[model samples]
Structures are given as C-alpha cells and as structure tokens.
Target: MSENTPLPIVEEDDWYRDHLATVDEHGKRVWIYPKKPKGKFTNYRTVVSVILLVILFGMPWIRVHGNPLFMFNILERKFILFGSYFPPQDFHLFVLAMIIMVIFIALFTVIYGRIFCGWICPQTIFMESVYRKIEYWIEGDSNAQRRLNNAPWTASKFIKKFSKQVIFFSIAVLVANTFLSYIIGTDQVLAIVKDPISKHTQGFLAMIAFSFAFYGVFAFLREQVCTTICPYGRLQGVLLDKNSVVITYDYLRGEPRGKIHKAVKGKEEEAAKMNALLGDCIDCKMCIQVCPTGIDIRNGTQLECVNCTACIDACDEVMTKVNRPTGLIRYDSEEGIRTGAKKIMTPRAIAYTSVLGVLVLLEIILFATRTQVEGLLLRTPGMLYQKTDDGYISNLYNYQFVNKTSDTLALEMELIGIDGRIKWVGHAPIAIPNDVTEGAVFVELPPSELQTGKNKITLRVRSGDRTVDQVKTSFLAP
Candidate 1:
C-alpha cells in the first residue's frame, strides 16, 4: 500500500508488513511502472554504474604477466588472481579470500543498510541504469508505459516491445560472454566463438543458457530478485538496527501530511492555523511514484527498500517546488531521525570489522609466503626394493609436481642425505603453467645406505639450479 491507500480501522500500520508491496491482497503480482528518476543521486549512480560495467567487461580481457587479471577455472582446477597463478594446491588461499569478502560485506551491511544493493549491486546497476533507462527511452515515462500496456496491441506497441527485447537479449549475450571469460579465460571464450558450434557444443550451449538467464532476470524478474531471491536482502533484517544508516523518511519533519494550499487575502489567520497543524510533507506521493520496488518511504524502513535514493531525489524535487527545505527522505539512521543522533560504530559492526581485518591480513600473509612450486614424492605402492646387478639397492617411486607460475618448470631431483642417484623410468617431467606433471623414478643406493624395512629419504627438487622444494618420503627395502 502507498500514501493513497485508505487506512483500515484496525492494524492499519501493520498492513504493509503482511505482504510485499509488489503483491496484491489476492496474491497476484502488482506490476510497477516507476517514474523515471532524476536528480543528483541518480546522476551519481549512473556514473558509478558506467565505471563498474567497464571494469566488469574489461577484466577478463586484461592480462597481467601472461595471465588473465582474474580467472577461476574450476573445470581445470586452476585459478589466477591478479598476476599470481594458483593451482588446486592453493585452494586453501582461495577459500580464505572468499571468507574475507563475505565478512567485509556483512560489516558494510551492519553500518549501512542495503547501500551496496542500491549503489554497487550488479542487479540494481543493470536494472536501473542500463535496462530500465533503455526502457524509459523507448516507452517514455511511467504514465506512457502504463497507458501503452493497458492499450490493446498495436503496430507501434509491437515495434517498441520487439525492439526493447532485441536490445535486452543482445546485452545479455554480451554479459554472458564476459562472465564466461572470467571462468575460462578470454582466450578460451574467443576460441569458443571462433570455433565451430559442433566442436564446442557444451560451451556454446552454456553461453546461450547464461544469456537467456540474464535476459529473464532483467526483462521480467527485475525487483523480485531483490525482494525474494537475494539472500543479502533477507540478511538485512538480522544485520540492520536503529543505528544503521538507510534511506529513511523523516517522520518528525514530514508526518501529519497534508496537501499544500494557498491562503485567501482576508483569511490569512485561519490559513496560518491550518498550516501550523500540518507537516512539511504535502502527500504528493511523488516518492512512491519514483521508487523502483514500489514502496512508500513514509512507512519507515521495509524489507523491500534497497536504499536506491530515487525517493530521496523525488522528495527533494517536490520540496524544492513547494518552497520547503529538502531531505524529507534522505540517508539517516532510525535513531537519527527520532533523536537526531547518528552512531554507526555499533558493537556488531566493530566485531565484524575486526574479524574482517584479521582475515584480510591472513590472506595477505598466506599469498606472500606461498611456494611457487610444490612437489609430492611417494614410493611406488606395490614395488619392493630390488637388487641391482652392480650391487646397488633400487626403489621405484612416483613423483608429482605442481607449477604455480606462468613459466614452464623443468624439474631435476637428487638425493639430499642418502648416497643415491635418480633414474627416471621414462623421462623427468617438465611442468607447465597452472599444470601438474607426474612421473616415475628409481632411487638406487648402495647396500650400506639401505635399512631393513624402511629408510628415510630426502629429495631436493630444483629447476635450473634454483631450489624449488625439499620433499621427504619413506623408501622401502628388504
């Protein structure tokens, strides 16, 4: 319900909580035609969206040290972040980084309610700044859109609707390709595009599916994603409190709302008395008209509120026209609106911040100290020590090396403490970028160095005279 809805005799204030603003009492969806929003906040959000979109589209193509700036190739168990290559061996680091990000978002939410959703969320940016703006350009403003929808299907209506869908799907396709590039690398995505569809059927189908999913989200789902599907929106009820800064209507300054009126020349005293009883708000419903999620700012904070600031701009514009001060709807905590005191550093916020800081630091340290190459040396499972013709004891072994660098690694291994020589069963492995190399080798030693059951052996692994890893494993002998 909005400002225009009639109040019920009982539970009038609680009615809005009973159902979503986009749902009717009969449980059907109420289509919203939000008025095109303008003002400083909208302009600012447009600029932010443009920058974010540029970064989102550009990141996959941007390379650092021969690696994509960011990649998470789960298919190959390879990940490259910034210029650093992380094989499956560094999965721990990736998990830690993810944890840090989650904690940071939670901390931000505790201090500023849903500001990320309004200003930085990809959903809000694409809906409000890209797709919705294009919709307004094609269908005109909210009134024109409503009228066109209500009117029977005409040639002009069909043309506008068709043109909008074509553009929306085209953009969705582009976004899907960009998203795939982040997962599989830009070169792979380009290969899929250049290759025959039959050759890359799975990749081609994945791209098309992703495109359709995105189109559905922007074209039809819209605000429902935020209201019902997003876990972050649901978390707001637990994360937010009276001290959290949000887009709030100043009930102290805007309550007892009445329509603006002019006084007659002789009845100025009566007009003044009437004005004294009213608040600054004129009940124009402009705030509701501009809200993307179809919420009334006058009803205080709700689950549907994204802190988009469209209502703020609309209310400010109305206030300016009516010769009243602006900020009827603006950024403020509930406590600030009631008591005029703003406090953002609550105990929950501090705790989350502290945990986030430690995680970030731990991630940094782990990344800095991580090994460039890792090796796993194991003795062959079924083989026992064999006697060589030259009076030497030989043990068969298997070795695996993980390369975490951009360059190829030609590994060489030698016995560290034992007097022995390594003979490759076939050839020693040459590790490639973000790949694992495995091989079998024989460690031959004199009988003096052999133990009765098992002997401790140390292997020093090197690449072109530079030590890579020192691995210790058990060598079996009879």
Candidate 2:
C-alpha cells in the first residue's frame, strides 16, 4: 500500500466481545453499582416481581385435596401436581414434562430472547427487586454505596454495613426455608422448626447451608450468576439470531454518536452544521450507568445482557431530556432495525413451537389417561412351576402395587387371556393407601392352557368395579 492509500478502520468497542462486562482484564470480579432505576418499565417489572415472589413463597402452603398444589419430593420419589399424585411409576411423565419444558424454552428464546431471565427468573427477581432494593434503602443509591465502600473503616460505615448484612442474611434464610418447603412440604418444614434440633438435625443443617448459599449469590456473585454461571446466558450465542427480539440499542438511528451542544453566541451556522452530522443520541452514558450487568448497550448485544430493560428506561429518559424521540434503546431485533420489519415466526421458532406443542399435548393425554393404580407382577426368583393335585401348573409371583390417589384402594386381581385362578399367598386382596404394597400370589392354570416353556399372561387389577390397572407377565411351564 502506498502512503496515499487510506488505512482500514477498526472498531474499538469490539473489545467487549473478549471479556465479560462484570470482570476486569485480570479475570477478577468487578463489582457493579447500578444507579437506582426509575421509569415506567421499572415500575412494571416491580409489579411483576411482587406477583411472582408472592406465588413462589405461597405455593407450598396452597393445598388441593389435602396435598400441596405442586410438590417434587425427589427423596421419596413422589410428585404431586394440581392434586394429582405420581409415584416412581409415573417417572416417564416427569421425563416428558422436562423435555417439553426444554423445547418451550428454546422456542421462547429463539423469538423473544432472554425475557424469561429478566422478568420471571427467580435469581434476577431476588437480586434486583429484593436484595438490591433493600441495599438501596439502607445505603442510599449507587454513588452513596460506592462512597461508603471506599471510605475508611469508621463506626458509621460499620453500623451501615452490619445492618445491611443482617437484613440480607435474614432474607436469604427466608428464601431458603421457602424453597425447602417446596421440596419437603410446608408441614415438614414447620415440623423441622418445631421439633427438637436433635431429631431434625439434617434438615436444619440443610436450611442453613442453603441460606448461606443464597446470601453469597446475591451479595457477592451478583451479575456473575447471569454472565458466567448460568447456562441459559451462554446459550444466547446459539439461540439468538438477527430476527430475535431483544433489548437492543438502535445503532442505526443513534450512531455517528456525538454530544449535544448549545450553539455558540455567534457561530450558530457552525454549530448547526455539526449538529447535522450527529444522531439522536447525545453521547450521554446513562444507559451504561443504569445497566445491571455493567455493559454498554451501544456496544451491541453481548452475552452478559439479561434483557432487563434498565438501559431502555435510562436511554428513554435521556432522549426525552434532549428533546429527541424516545426509544433510542428499546426492544427490537437487528433485522428490524436494519430493514424496518419484525418477523417472529421464523422457521426455527415455528419448528420448535410445533415440537413443543406436540409434547405438551402428549403430556396432557398421558396425565389424563394415567391409571389410578400401577401394578407390577413378576415370577418369584429361583422358583419353578409346581404341579398340583388338581392337574394344574402353578407359578409363584410377587406383586407390587402403587396407589396414585388420595383414597385407599381395595384392589382385586383377576386372570386375563389364560384360564387361571389367582390364589393369594397371604391376603385375599391388596389394600393400598397412598404408598406401595407388596404381596405374593399363586397363578394356577390347567395343563391344557400351559405352553411348553413361557406363556404370556395378563392380570387385571380392579378397584371396586373400575379397572385400575392391567399388568402383563410371562408364565413359565414344563
């Protein structure tokens, strides 16, 4: 290249791609102190957070048919959904539900970006709305917080910090207890609190561990949970595309950035000429100042962004003050910014939605068609056919019954397909109540109905007059 040739232009802001906004170049965490956000969007998010928090803390206590509305007792292998009981036998339904959830999240992310993280995620809700709000109340806003941290260790600072820590830890404990209730039931949690510590030592310790974990996450980890720890944040690179609607800086309308300046006393023509070259943005960094994750929205979308809309509120305020039309930073897609069009139903999103719909429908059908009881019958181990005096071939079998309802089941078993008589080894019928029942029975079939080696047989289990379950097993013969 000759001296006359122009040098290629390079983007300085592209450096943001190499490192997280919440981390310094040394790989150490950079604490964020976002200015207290105030705008219509912030208010809307507060309402939503309040509603979600209420639902979360209250769900364990909400009962239907004498059981929690929703409970996932993984320890006992019991799950209750909307008063429906599911034992280990219904694990397939649980698996299908998880698959459906994954597909739904993919579909939602492809079209709407990480709105879930910003609006409904429990982490963001507690950090921004709960803990952070409390901090702001105790220590004042961002500038005040910075000053307090940077100041010498005085009694005032110690008192303020101590009070904040106490409140933060208290909230963490409450959060831990609330979540524990979801897993173990509110009654169990209350029992652990009311009972002797020696009797519930493990549960008490678990609650303490969870409390400290929550405290550390909200107090220290903060934005790192979204930027570095959460897999959903990392997934943005793969899930998001030009068509996805996300919290975006309208670089097309706000670029060629320059500060807004008043005209000089006499050089009005020059000032007007310079103003013509500038865009709506006045180069004020209010967006960056209000960002929770500490990224500049003007740098374009990055993984650390949680779509919290704080930047949108801040930018809109700045724009309004500058007499410029608002929405310099707003919810939009790259394609929409470039072409002035938005398309949500892309092929990828449509495909994901289709798959999600099918799975959800299948889940509903399976849940509706699920039996009240599930039974499993197997031939007794190391036992063979016994020839009876009545010229019948007998096989000893062990049966396990899972009751999936609140009511006790008086179940009677009958042979199907093969002409056989079921004789209970211990009891005549099985009584299952809210748990599993194990028993033994002898299935006797005439030699005419027996096969040479293995014969397929079905057992119909009935509760009163309704068929609750049907189990199939093989009968071994001579």
Candidate 3:
C-alpha cells in the first residue's frame, strides 16, 4: 500500500464490451433465437401485460361523460383526458402530464431498474407475449427455429413461414387500428375502415404504413428496439446505481464455475476436506439460452438486460436439479450481491420520489380547477363609444366563447361591476355550441358609472342558474 508501489494494470474484457450481442465483428446482423421462457415470474408478467394491453386497446372505446376517455388528436390540436376537453389553449395541461410521466418513470428507474421495460412496455409485451408466441407455435423452440433457418427452402419451411407472416401481418393491422384509435378516436377509425379508400385517402395510407412498420418491428427488428433504439435503455447507465434493484447474477457464489459430472457426486466432501475451490454454478448455459437480448447475465448488469428475470428462472431450475441452492441469479441490487446489503431508500431515490410526488399533486390540482368553459371579450378595434339619446354610453365589443363540455350551452352575459346592459347584435341570448362560438355585442353603461376614456369591465357568462366563466376587458369611453 506504499505510494512508491506501482498499481497493476488491469485488462478489460473487450470482446463482449466492444460490440452489440446482435452484431458481429464483420458488422452483420446476428439474429437471436431465444428459447421460450416459462416460470412463476413469466406467468405474472403475462397477466400484467394482458391487463395493460386491454387498457391500451379498449380505452378509445370507453366513453366518459359522452366523450372518449382518452384521445390525442394532434392534427386538430385537441386532446381529451378522462372526460375533460383540452383545446390548443389548454396545451399546458398536456405538457404538465408529460412532465409528470417522465419524472415518475425516472423515479421508478432509480428505485427498481428497468422493470417497466420488461413487464409493461408495449413493445416487449406484444413481441414476447403475442408475436413470439405465434412464432413458437409455428416454428417451435429456439433450436427448431435455428434449424429451420439453416435448412433449404422446402415446402414445409415455406408453409410455416408463409402462415406465420400472414398471421403476423393480420395482428400488425389490428395493432395499427388500435394505435390510430388512440390518436383520432375509435369512431373516426371505424369510418376509415367502412368508407372507400378514395374518401379517406390519408387515413387509409396511414393505416397501411403503420401496419407494415409494426410488422417489421415485431417480426424483424425485435430486440434491437430495446438495445440500440430506445433512449430509456441507454439512460439506465445514468439512472441506476449500486442500490437499484435489478436482475443480477450473484458472481460471488457462482464464480470459478465448473461443469457438473458424475465424478463430482462425492467430491463435495473431499473438496471441503482439502479446502479445494468450487462454486455453485455448474455452467449449464441455460440462462444464456433463454435470454431474449442474447447477453450473459454472469457478465454483470448490461444495458441489454431488460430485468426480465428469465435468467433467474432458468438458473433456479438448473440449481434445483443439481441439488444446489437456488437464487444464483435473482432480483437484487449490486450492493446486495457484492456486500449482502439491501437498501431501497437511498438519498438520490428519496429526491426523485419527492419531485415525482410534487408533480403528481400539481397535476391533480390543475385538473380539479380547470373550467368547463372559456371566454374572451374585447372592444372592437378603432371603435369609439357613442353617446345615446338616453344619456347612456355604449361600447361595441366582440365576444368569443369556447365550450369545453359535451353539451350545448345557451349563455347569457351580464356586466359584473358597474350598472350596464348587454345587448346581442343579432340575438337576445347567445347560443354557444360545444366547440366555439363568436358574436358581437353592445355594452351600454350610464355616464354616471363611467370613469374615464379607458375603463375595465368584468363580464360574467352564465348558463341558466350556474355561472360558467368570467372575462375582463377594456371598455372605451369618451
């Protein structure tokens, strides 16, 4: 430990570190054929994925207060959350919602690693649970798939490949329709489906493009989406720490691995007597076989690992068969595996949680206080007040009202502060439709109530007995 003593140079394992598992030194794509995984964790993930998928697909169809529960019509700058309508003016609420979601995801990653990517991500869920299952049914397990790929193009191969493609294409179309529903509402999507291609050319083309994109993603560009494309996967390196719980391999117990053999049956006692070194890992390689990302869990926490827990299940099954303790791989933190210390509430995690909590509270408050109607009243440009024969000063104004609710509203406007009478130019009571209504009105106030050339007027908008909105504008006076 002396200062004069030179530190030893350490060589890094560059083979696996230099390139992606799905690529080779020649830069060609190395297709992965992951063995189908099954265990308690996979079963739990399946249930969760199914529930999330149902919500994603069915939400567009569910109506709340006669409005689609969730719709983001970006083309028209309109968005609806729950039953509340948000126009271009309410874009702040949408931005706030997005910020809340980002903070929530960051906090979750700081605490629990990439559990969301593995269990609830739509890409993973549809790829593994749906498309991959279909592939397994048609092409069998990894070995069979590999064999089919290596074999010549025969009738059997053609039939299997063609059938799988047909089904995959159909599912992709369905997924595209579901995705379009979220953007433009299910009713619009149904109209596009029922009408001729010439009627809705853009929508029809969009549907076709989305279907092919989905097909290419699920069938060809599967794991690359997570490893190479997704920004969240790359962000794990910054968000995760020693305390973050992830699917980790217990290298302390499994290192210096040796293959199991018949000679090792009674060798445990002999090794113990001689102080011989031997670890629990038998090097079965089952974990690698079941990994969708094609990375070895024993190499430590890699970006490719989605925290899927497939390695844990595979390793546990192997350990049980060999009469060794399970959990050679498990859901644990780096510190837990290295020093046997489990801690979830680190200082960084606490900070993230605090910020996330505040954002969520702000969102709730914003939604609760949002008005059902919006109104804007302004004096007509370059217009002067006219003194009527009755000694009343009248100002010409234009009014615009936006109805956020689903029902038609017959609105009446009254001056709030001073004594004034509101007279609609065309109608006695202005009828505001569900979207937007514009009209002109004349506000006549007694000269005794007028202050100066420029006066502030408060207008109250009412629907029947309920006051809906209040708007303030400048009134011109001589």
> By TM-score, who's the top model here?
2
Residue 264 alpha-carbon offset, candidate 2, angstroms: 2.4
lDDT of 3 by residue, 228-293 (tens): 999999999999999999999999999778775444676877656433366788888899999999
RMSD over all Cα atoms, model 1: 3.5
TM-score of candidate 2 to 2 decimals: 0.95
In model 3, the Cα lDDT at residue 39 comes to: 83
Q: Candidate 1 regions off by >4 Å?
A: 1-10, 389-392, 445-451
Two-way lDDT contest, 1 vs 3, winner? 1
- Of candidate 3, the 10-residue stretch with the lowest lDDT total is 7-16
TM-score (all chains, Cα) for each model: 0.94, 0.95, 0.93
Error at 1, model 1, angstroms? 24
Scored by CA lDDT, what does every candidate get? 0.90, 0.89, 0.88
* Candidates sorted on TM-score, descending: 2, 1, 3
lDDT of the structure predicted as candidate 3: 0.88
lDDT of 1 at 310: 97
* Poorest 10 consecutive residues by lDDT, candidate 2: 7-16
Q: What would the per-residue lDDT of candidate 2 be over residues 1-478, giving only the tens digit for each residue?
A: 9979975554766767666777776778788999999898999999999999999998899988788988888887778888778887889999999899888888889999989999999999999999999999999999999999999999999999999999999999999999899789999999888999999999999999999999999988899889889998889999998999999989989988999667999989889898889888888888998889999988888888998889989998988887889998999998998899978889998889888888999999998899888899999999989999998999999989988888877888998877888898877655555588888999999999877999999989998899999999999899
